[model samples]
Target: MKSRDYSQLMQELSEAYAHHSPRSAAIHQTAVQYLVDGGSNALRTIEPFPPRIIAARGAYVTDEDQHQILDFWQGHYANLLGHNPEVVTRALSEAFANGFGLQTGFTDLLQVEVAEMLCRQTGAEQVRFTTSGTLATMYAMMLAKAFTGRNLFMKVGGGWHGGHLWGLKGVGYHEGFKEADSAGLPASVMKEVVITQFNNTEQLEKDFHRYGNKLACFIMEPVIGAGGLMPARREYIQRARELSEHYGVILIFDEVISGFRYRAGNVAALYRVQPDLMTLGKAIGGGMPVAAVAGRRELLQLAGSEHGGKVKFQGGTYAAHPAAMIAAKVFLQYLIENETQIYPRLAELGAKTRKVVTHAFEEEGIHVRFAGDRLTDLPGSSLHMLLFPYQEGLELSTPEEVRNPHVCDITLSEKVLQLALLLEDVFIMHGLGCTTLAHTEADLEYLGEACRRVARRIKPYL
Candidate 1:
């Protein structure tokens, strides 16, 4: 099929998006009245308002304007069973009927059940529930520090653990710290964190040798989700484990996005490298807000004051809320019952989609990289990408010549975003330009077709 002119197509779609999205516009106006910067938050992962979603079912969301969109984003990779699945809804409903919140110790069965399930799946001895992934990691750090009597921590560069000050320090966004990924965090607070590049064994060994004594723990995403979905080499992870063991540093795996996606365990399971502590979230609660820190008995027991704990404090009123606990339990139950069928199916679908999209980009002469292709035979979830425009032999040219060209002024990034938005308009949504289990073969074909169309549209600029 002949591709349409993307710039002109974008202009036309932009007009249609404005004119046809009256409900979205009204929702955006109302949100702006209450929320700052028109109801937006940090990360700016999603496009700004007229950003209104009215309803969602399995693999689909309907905006306020009633445009049914194919949701590859899948709630930032949280909805493993897909949006509003009957199983999750039933679990939530049952938990709500029992009670939303209990001031004192009420029924602890749900919490216990979730912990037991996680332990069985991940081979962890104990688990602690938390309200969010940030809290889970923070508490894990504190526990590691308390158990080992160390003050400093280490994280791989480009890995996002959470929004906490320490986790954000090595993200390359903060100016005051040596490397800060986000602003507003104090440089003093970040000094305690040491950064190491992923897959760089020499640097990791050197850093461990230099700071192992003072380092409390080393935390990293088994698969770097936000850090462009970079997967660590097995040798790299195994080396980390050896170094940590050698130095007495606790190793923590932040599996927030990986948990319950490929398998009930995680990337750690796939890599066959065990960490001292594993943090989980995203799919654990089946679309609810929940996270966990699981570890060996000695480490987890540090949190309990009754056991002569050295760890300070970790629990909150909502730490083990009945609703979230029940949701997690049901989600795990579903995973256990359908593991053989569900996991293989997701893997097959993911592989096919990656192949189709990669081939489409190659045929169109677009410079795009898919994480799914890079991490093939690896049992994990989430299909992500890092896209750049083909530079037209610009690499061989001198810096001056490359910078002098005004044609390069219009970035490939703008075109990519425009194409993504166009896909959204036609009912295919991406989560920060990534796909997930919610997508089927037909959905991926839809995306591939969209890419072909987009390539044609941007051919003139290229």
Candidate 2:
């Protein structure tokens, strides 16, 4: 490759991005007075300013500046059926119209339906609702300890289970650094957690042996989301199942991003690797904040079946909120009914998109590529495509190479690409791009066009 122009390209793109959304910049500036750092979620707060979304319908979002941009972010990958989907919205509307109360502080009939659907889909013995994926994972870890009578938790090094205290260790891999991701978190909590590299069975064995009888649960995402969209190798997952059984440790799959993204409901069903406990979120809500911790009856029952019974399973004021349950029930049932159509199309779109993007960069003499799960075996098809900017000695032929932290520079590449794509009228989520069913061939063509423009501009940084 020719000497890349990292500085000049960035300066030009920076200026162009600033020019692209003056309204968003203004909005964020005003927001800083009330909202911390101009936004609640640190991830969505972009450098210049995150786009001020005014309206979102189907595959597009209209920014505060009135720019009708085609959106691939899909509400941070929560809108698997696309924004304001008819079925979900209708369900919500009918519930509200029927005098269904919000946060009624009582068991909801909708919860029963939603739980039944989740149980049927995942073959889980029991299901319990939560307000967010963070809570689901946190409760899941607690339940594991309760059931197994163990103290330690094991998780993949670069996995993102949530922002909970126990789940904060080793979120992003920095060579020679194995510390927790946040400040102000108790150092004591990090000690009880053991981190192992994804797709590395050898390291897993070592960690298991190191933790031994104290290890309560081994929790992981089927596809590592934040660090990189790395899919666990089939053999590696099987090994996890085998070891969990041998050690009597509960296995928990954090499917917050993968639930229903692969084949209607869960990756475990698609991959045939069952876990003792599973956390479901993101797409299940269709836009609302909803999640659930589901698993074997024996394990979940340890939390207590009756009110004030044995152990506290956990109950939030917003857990199983009637509106969210109705929406989730409608979305999950629809997805299950249309699984044959929805999943394959998503996988195909992912494969086609990877080709379009890679080809776009190649044409500009850029060596850019997406990192994991290529072609039909779309393990990372949770609508989040982890971009791998060109790097040396990075293997693309196998799934086992997920542990290589140098697979790409996500921090810089993701930020730059988001700005570039935004300026091109394509809205991506923190540069973690996604695809929705509402995304058509024309939208894809626009994506390719935008990528071609971005690649040419980023030629110096290649």
Candidate 3:
């Protein structure tokens, strides 16, 4: 078989995309005059400009070009109940109708209500609400450093905790996981953050042995997001817990993407290894911007008034906004009440989509593997990411392997496939993206057919 020409293919796909969505292209062109890179978020800004979405509901988003595109990005994988889920929206509307509003910057009963729900659901002794995953994770790290009196922290390569200071290193694969993700970060701060390989227990143990005494914390995602959406092994998580305990390091689980994803609460519960602190976001807000750092009382109390305000994590002005809190409360209640039905159905749909899409590509003589399933063969994934490995027999177990161009066709999956599918009126991030409860069998069928069409169109490039 001939090698794929990803650059040539991307050029062709970008031309086709611009031709199909002229309005979006024009909107992006206008946006570039103000917004950096024509967007606030870098990931959303793709080649030839991204489609300017005007409205979104259920499993589809309407672009400015009047195209109703089938969406799988699903609000950065936060829309478990789909865009503007009625259960959450109606509750927010009712709150507004009852004279409630947003961002008053005062403590309200709604904050306590949602915080109590989170504590009860996730086995956390305390909870502190924030506005985003970045702030939440940053606060968690600060708490860890303050409590442990250590400076060094450890995170796996390609694990994206957000755009915060502690999260700026070892995130993207483009630099081969060697340099800081951003340009302005201090070298002194970046050096204190030790990097480790995901799911590699031996390397983790070695690092812990070398830097465990000086390390304040070891933060990781149980279901590694951005890195590949791959779940860690049971033993690996168990070992992490054991080592953190022995080394006096605060183990922090960054569950921004995984929390409330596999179940009603945190995915840490599934691993049976509770970290000292867990950062929650994305799905927990019910499509609103709400995030939190919750865990043992002592650590969380560092941010409290009684503790002399060690961490400075009093939260921002939008912390526990009334409407967002109500939305989160209603969404969590619905998820808890329908846990058995919601989770199983999500897993089933995700598995079905993965299998069908893989089959679609295989029919066109294309070989691809997905990185959504658990290493233990567990059937609980609601995310699917297709990867084209360099060889037929190689397994994608780590972030390096998943993002390395020599090991896998990173450009083919991230850029070429993305542009190709957008022309088919389908949107995906990290390949197939996440499955929402609002997605139906018919939607899955549409997605499968779209993949098949995309495969045939791009087959000759390979």
For model 3, residues 90-152, the per-residue Cα lDDT tens digits are 887888888886667678888898999999999999999999999999999999999999999
Instruction: Show where candidate 2 strays beyond 4 Å.
Output: 1-8, 305-310, 374-386, 389-393, 396-407
Models ranked on TM-score: 3, 2, 1
CA lDDT, every model vs. true structure: 0.69, 0.77, 0.89
Instruction: List TM-scores for all candidates, in order.
Output: 0.86, 0.93, 0.97
**Candidate 1 ranges beyond 4 A from true positions:** 1-16, 43-45, 48-50, 95-107, 172-178, 307-309, 375-381, 389-419, 422-437
Of the two candidates 2 and 3, the one with more favorable lDDT, higher being better, is 3
lDDT tens digits, residues 1-462, model 1?
Answer: 132334654565556566777777667677767777565554322333444787888877888777877666677678876788788788677656776644345656778888999999998999988888888999899989888988899987656788887787756423212466667988676678998766567878999999998999999876776544556767778999999999999999999987777787767888888899999998898887789999798999887866675675465667777767767788889889989987887778766766676677679876654432344436444555434423443321111111122313223433345434444553323222445556777877877777667666555654
RMSD, one per candidate, in order: 5.4, 2.6, 1.4
As for candidate 1, its clashing pairs are 6-457, 70-427, 173-180, 173-181, 174-180
Which candidate would rank higher by lDDT, 1 or 2? 2
Q: What does candidate 2's lDDT look like per residue over 1-462, in tens digits? A: 233345666677777777877888788879989998899888778766788888989988898888988887787678887889999888888777888847788885788988998998888989988888999999999888877789899887767788889988887555622778899898797788887777677888888777857889999887767645656677778889988998999999999988888877778876678999999999888788789999898878877754234557565888888888888888888998998889888877876776777788778876655655443434536354545544655554322333343555454466778778888888775344678788887878778888899877765565
